[model samples]
Target: MALFNKMLASIGIGTAKVDTRLDSDRYLPGQTVQGKVEIRGGSVEQKIEEIYLTLHTTYIKEQDDKKYTQTAALEKLRLNDPFTIAPGELRTMPFSLVLPNDTPLTYGRTKVWISTGLEIKNAVDPSDEDFIQILPGPIVHAALLALTDLGFKLRQAECEAVSYKLNHHRPFIQEFEFIPVTGPYHGKLDELEISFLSVSEERAEILLEVDRKAKGLAGLFAEAMEMDETMVRAFITKQDIPQMREKLNQIISRYI
Candidate 1:
């Protein structure tokens, strides 16, 4: 029976299992996430080659008319060296992984998670996935709040393909689309889209697309022809905001 159990475990019948427990439900970019992976042995002893943890998120890549959802690996961490697990034994390993400064925020349909994998010799590897929410970092949070203060109403946001000029690791980026209901930009603009290509504690790089409100007969023709939008790119340090809010008023004036 013992021999049968070992063979069965090797074939993934009753193998060791992994469970990851995070210290918190929410994490921020550039923050070190502390978690523990608990491995519980199954019916028999097994030799685990190594343990790995990875951060994963989905991206959409379109080819022709079909779209494919591809998983992007933000980071990987090797948990430990090879070890043996006796039947019914439980081992807990603690880990601290620093999130990427540009980790995509969990907004709308976007999802982010950490996966734990146990590599074993000649056996179907066991794995576990734990989903978590990613909140904007300090600089990003402040910028979003400032936009709210400026009367820009944030609407839908999504992760999509970004141009190379944005300068990002992954092939896509998250854009927050806004429309001014009040404040300085109210009537002059039709839409505004902001993409945070690079975000850190000190500074953040932004890509802004401004759509001008059409007017007059020529403007009406331009609107009909879809020629009313302009794109702007800029970067701001943490020290720039609030005052930058006032400066933003001036900068947007030029865009209009």
Candidate 2:
């Protein structure tokens, strides 16, 4: 009993407590995430200036060929404004958050953390970080599998901050690079870069950049192209490995 009391004190439960639970452990892009944030009062009453939930993801920023870790806030929600919790009281607040469609799904299981916090002026700040697993959707997985089946190997993956100068919402672009399979075109293509934009259940924009190796007569050049929703859907779902390889080869041949 004495040890239990000491453990509770270490957590500042005598002040305030917070717990956030998600409705579902696994979620898809463009889906609403439902959760409950429960706050339990401690030995004494406390005044909370505000109660809010924040969603964050980690990325790497590259500058001058150097990389640095960066944490970005994706979304935020406010539950209450200046609320008072009396001693021996327990309160639970429900929250429904719609995750961004373009959120990157980790290769396998990515850990995404959400924080529920109560802001207090004098007392220790009480907060909870919940780790959620992010799984890749069928469309995304299919595309990658097709590329792999075609003999293209994954080279690198990274998230880049991109500005179109015409879009309203700031977009973070995740780029996947692959090495070409076999053929004269295999060595001819330095790498295949793919990007997903405006990603959602209904539609997604696909962007491709092909870096071509320079021939004796041809100079090194890169071609960039954007595919519409209909084309993207067709390419991901309908095309097979051979067809995908041909489609990519055709695109590369035109430039060379």
The residue-by-residue lDDT of candidate 1 on 1-256, one tens digit each, is: 9988878987999999999999987998888989899999988889999999999888777789898887889999998989999989999999999999888889877899999999988678999999889998777877777777788988877787767775668888888888898988898898888889888788988888888899899878877887877777788788876576665565567878
RMSD of 2: 6.3
Q: TM-score of model 1 relative to the true fold?
A: 0.91
Indicate the TM-score of model 2.
Answer: 0.73
Q: Per-prediction TM-score, please?
A: 0.91, 0.73
**Judged by TM-score, which candidate is best?**
1
Worst 10 residues of 1 by lDDT: 242-251
Which ranges of candidate 2 are over 4 A from the true structure?
A: 1-13, 108-111, 163-168, 181-185, 214-256
Residue pair clashes in candidate 2: none
Q: lDDT values of the candidates?
A: 0.85, 0.66
